[model samples]
Target: MATPAAYDGLISHAGSLFWIQSGEGPDQLVTWTASDGVSLAAPQGFELGNEIHAYGGGAVTASASGVWGVSSKDGRIYRLTSDKAEPLTGHTGDQLGDLVVRGETVLALREGTNGDQLVDVDTSTGHVRVLLQSSSFLSSPRPGPGYVAWLSWDADHMPWDSTQLWVARYDDRSGGSLGTALLVAGGHSESVLEPQWGPDGSLYFMSDRTGWLNLYRWDGERTYAVAPMAADCAAAPWELGYRSYTPLENRKIAMRARRDLEDHLLLVDESGHSETFQLPFTAIKPYLCTIDNAVAMIAATPTTAPAVVLVERDGSYAVIAGQEPSQDEVRQPERHSADGIDFLLHPPIDAETTWRAPVIVRAHPGPTDEISLRRDPQLDFFTRHGFAVADVDYRGSTGHGRAFRSSLYGNWGSYDVEDCAAVARHLITLGITLAGEVFICGSSAGGYTALRAATTTGPFRAASARSPIIDPKRWEASVPRFQRAHATALATGATAVSSAAIECPVLLVHGLHDPITSAQDTAALASDLKTRGADHELLMLDTSSHTLAAPDLAAQVLDAELRFFRRMLDQSESAKRT
Candidate 1:
């Protein structure tokens, strides 16, 4: 029962670290100081979460003065004190998130049924005023001395696919209204993210103008490339408040560059001279904030769990939230490349004691996501049970250039499926797995790929899909507005998986309350499989979300998956013996 606690949304203000913690209990906002250590910022019964985009981030913001966050129970902004939680907004039915503080205003991105709006909440009066509201989506509403910068995109594009960086002057004459806006950078092909105001009053942002997301500086009049590199310095803006880099003291920049499927921390100077700093972590989250001369991030190693680490200039760090787990006898990944696709192959733990172990081919979700060499408890569970796991970074994965990621724009189903199958075949050729013992599993988009592979490909003996998208077009219609465009793009050439074509034993597990993928569609697929007499089992969890992040539910899922795979393996072995 490995219920590893989860940490996210790391930020620093006035030498105090604030982050969101879950899994130990209800999700809570935690504040850490050198003097007081770690303590809950909210009351004991209060849970903090942001639901702006369905998949929320940047739910809380803090400074030396006070701490403010959006409550998960009610999608309203709340100001937290020592023991009291006061709601600042009425029951407007609008979700507020991506919280930031500037002057005396708490700026947040408000998502309502009408659309998205960038608004400011007065710290003293709790007055909500719309700063700008025309784009279909808005994020990162950063307020500076005399200007406000944010990222906006239309309904036809995801923030990563395309976005525009805009800045507007603040007119204090009429109680501080945003004046005429200026298009600083970004267009249809260019994606911009993390607009931060530097100490020198220049706006710093990450843009993929040259097909690689690099650092740039905007001095109001013109934009200049600060440190241009082939590697991407930003991630897909799946959630708000994503910061890949932060401007430090003396015009210096601390950033995480994704290269070779891992994150490397680098320091960029005023002259664009970059230096790499070695650290114990290989995977870094999409949040970075500066504390004094050091940077705080949610980072992890291949063997250690994810933690809120305050990293110094010389690459040394101290844990702020989660502690570093033990590294004893951890199974390291064997990086492999097959057909220009990258994957991390983890052999069964104690492989010497096993004979012809089965292999699990994992298709990562997002279909646009990448799998780093981080410590994954699920992967460890499979390997410890005599199962080799192949964590495939199929096409459309980030960290690679924009071309590689957008290659699946209209070819999502085919390209990603082919890549995963190619990795399994490559493993078979290397004698790491047997041909008849290959299994495939995925969640969300990856689950769709697993179902497609089991139906089309022969090497796979069993398949597992959790909250899978049985019908792409249907999914596009059911998903939130923020993901509708991206889903439509990915489902351009993909059709629904036909249950009648499934021959291999399949396991379907879906959370009834999954917000992203359609749970009703999964149930329909289960019914279809049953009618067709397909060998399958459907495990419907009553209270799990998309990831089944709960400890007990996650454990149940892992145990069920292992049992299903082993049953198939035993049946195959018995047939061979007969």
Candidate 2:
């Protein structure tokens, strides 16, 4: 009913039930159904928040006897009971943070927006307990009801060198007195990410201890690696990103993993047996779910995003749930037929509401062969702001197989640039975009290509990029700890076309916290742009990793881009009017 809601996490009660909020809805959305999958309804007037990095942060806080939906929006515990849904915790001024429910009592744990204090409020008696009120911050609870698992933090919030996992048990009827908190798991070079309980009472989580998001299980005694993925398992970390699972127990635990390096799902059993399959869709999550050891899961294929696919123990597939976006809602870019190769043209959502939208042609990072419209939030944000962004599945992005994806091979800067120009040329001919008004941009590998096109083959006047993976030689020697080896993957074979190819009036945003590409590398590149006499400005976001922080920071980068295009293309009025 809305413009594509991202169903990141899933849980089941008596019948197949889930909690969902619209992708563009506010933070406090409540669209849950009964246990029977009947009566799918959303709470009136309460929309889900579109804040930064809080996917699946809220949950259904139900007890064994009675169930209630809970959330930490506006510092209040908005609940859905047998009658009308209302606030269960907090008076009028207090804001509730992250909380869970046990039996009859609801414990709403609140730490101020910036202050450091854990305020535990009881849902039944309205009693409050200040648990270790400190000046430091506590990260979101790692979600388990009876076993309340939380991570400790100090003032810095810069990630603890050695953080410990703390768990506590409590009965609401007695008192909000959380049982003795004890450190159950700790002492790792890596941080503890999303922890889920298996059907058999084991704690399952993903850690980069081995440089990849691998599966690990923990009882009270020790944590063991459930399944070890390939070395390239994580191109990045699990910080605010994702992985998948819905365990009945640790034994019959079902999980979806990133295999072959993209967002594909895999099936894993307790014995550590693993089977890789093509997810129904590359974008939506493919979760392996089960009950009482008999398995069922909602998976997607390349054809669709997360159509609920249940797996039988005997290994048969069944599509049980979830909705697919209508073809019209999913803006499929027109395929431009040129040079015996057909390219997909993806338009932004804002294009549908208005006409003559400013089209930005983009070159993807990977030059692997295929036709793909990789769903990216950044891209969506562009559309959300009312720009028609068109990305090229030109000669190289992967999915069509290796041949198409690897077309650029050693010629990264040159070939992808050509594709960008070609897409622009085709779009102009198709009459979707004006030739002079189209803008081009990309990041890392794609950034290089965008700037290259702006100078050499393309007519676009402005360019924007994020933490570009420029100067292969410089990048290789001084990359981040996790991506030292991935430098070679930038090209198929090796060598050639220089950075001199990228000469556009560029707006560059780099992250100082970039461990992947050195901040020095970004500065050096910017200086080189000046020496080469290109009209360029470089701004860096503090404490931000490559993706940067959310909301305000991301808006700044984009607004700068808006100004860049407006100045050069002379389309501010057109941009404004649209």
Candidate 3:
């Protein structure tokens, strides 16, 4: 019952025994200790500079500390306690993203893959302290010594338009700067994102006006309402890399759903109390694992990928099943080529502490690069709501090799956006990630590499870009002729650019019955991000087309993207003292 690639990743030491972020090299993070199930010692050469597929957080702590991660050229923060690995550089802005950890200090929350430095590193002292920036897009870093709550959007085009809800509190031993950001709850026709912070401070997030997708709380002083809109929701508050574990107790906030029905393990305390643990296993894919005292996850099917059975704590479930999931010796088989590139790396199972998981970069669609991870129960509803997903086949996108899928013929968006931003900055130098809270999704040519990763090279925080072909001269002057001969080499190297140099906040879902990315090219790409202003939001749905992965339109696009990233990511600890 363990031969689906051996079903890697359930608990090889507890963290990432066999976690993956999609194929290729230099992005190590492979563990397997407890005395070898197949051997995976790890650590050597360790190089991820200039970054390629980078995304590793900053902590294995109980051992490795002060971590923050991300790459494809920058956004690092390291301070590994034992085994010496100090690499904190303040903040220079290249790649590093939505990350957290305040106790021993390591909160890299960034977004400037090009402009807007949201810095916060100190991992002992590489000292990069900025705290805020323009055209923002942050989330992760909820509670703090004095204060810290994030979820912002000063308006990029319409990115959930007119958004706000940012909390701050300087002097956490002197890291000052965040005097203004009051406005707890804006108009929110499109914003009020994911502000977590549970344990007791009570922040819990995810909102969508009243339309659906619910789960809210604020109590740093006000904002109440607790759980209702379920286009498919379950007490929002993710961290475990996508949405795997958010157990907070007393005030409660458990989760592990399949939305409407079927896959269950839902909780939601604080007053909302929404119960359901039922599990005999039908969960096509669910993974909200790890919360200590009790809360583990892993449910699979699509030929199979299970390890699940551990529901414990009065409830009962300690079923081991074959015994797989181990690969976090912090992998290093060592291999990387450049002539047309050849890479290799499939190790990342930090054995728990908090090693991070979810990567799923996978984007081909450019001339059918087909790479596969097929199944689709919304990928098991994003691994039963806890994500450790990964998949990427870049080089112009396809299954692999054909001159690497014709090298995007004339460089269609430069080697599949530099091999999907070099395999997410090579798994952020192999720590597995503490920064780049990437969700660089795709659809039409991987939604043009998740909309060219919000204007070429990002420190990504969420990009659910479905049906995006992104201006290849407006898709070869409006497609047609046998699909414009398979998009004449990506509209002769795509030209009509201008999603206003894209400054992050996009949620653009499409399909008013999309035939081939046309609902007037997503309403003229949301009217060219409102004539080049940029911070967009589109959502068309209805009869919906262009397989958004399906399963009831990927459960109404993961419930308006966890309520448009929980109102862009709330940070009000009750306005932190406004």
- Regions of candidate 1 where Cα sits further than 4 Å from its true position: 171-174, 352-356
Candidate 3, residue 304: how far the Cα is off, in Å: 1.7
Decoy 3 TM-score against native? 0.28
Identify the leading candidate in terms of TM-score.
1
Supply the TM-score for candidate 2.
0.56
> TM-scores across all candidates?
0.97, 0.56, 0.28
Top-lDDT candidate index:
1
Over 4 Å off in model 3, which ranges? 1-150, 157-193, 202-244, 248-293, 296-412, 417-442, 447-512, 519-543, 548-578
**What's model 1's lDDT at 503?**
72
Q: Tell me the lDDT of model 3 at 158.
A: 21
Q: lDDT per residue, candidate 1, 1-578, as tens digits?
A: 26567888888888888888887578877888889999888887787887788788888998654889888888888889659999887778788899998767788899988789988887778888888886598998887768889888998899998999989886322466788889999899999999999999999999998999999998878888998899988988788889999989889999999988789999998688999988878899988999887999998888777888888888787887776745656677778999999888887777763345689999989877889778888888998898989889888988898998999888977898899889988988878788888999999999999998878856898999988999998899889988999999998988788888787888999899888888888888889989988889999999748977577788889999999999998998999999
Worst 10 residues of 2 by lDDT: 232-241
**Predictions in order: lDDT:** 0.86, 0.54, 0.49
State which candidate, 2 or 3, has the greater lDDT.
2
- State model 2's lDDT: 0.54
Clashing pairs in 1: none
C-alpha RMSD by candidate, in order: 1.6, 11.0, 24.2
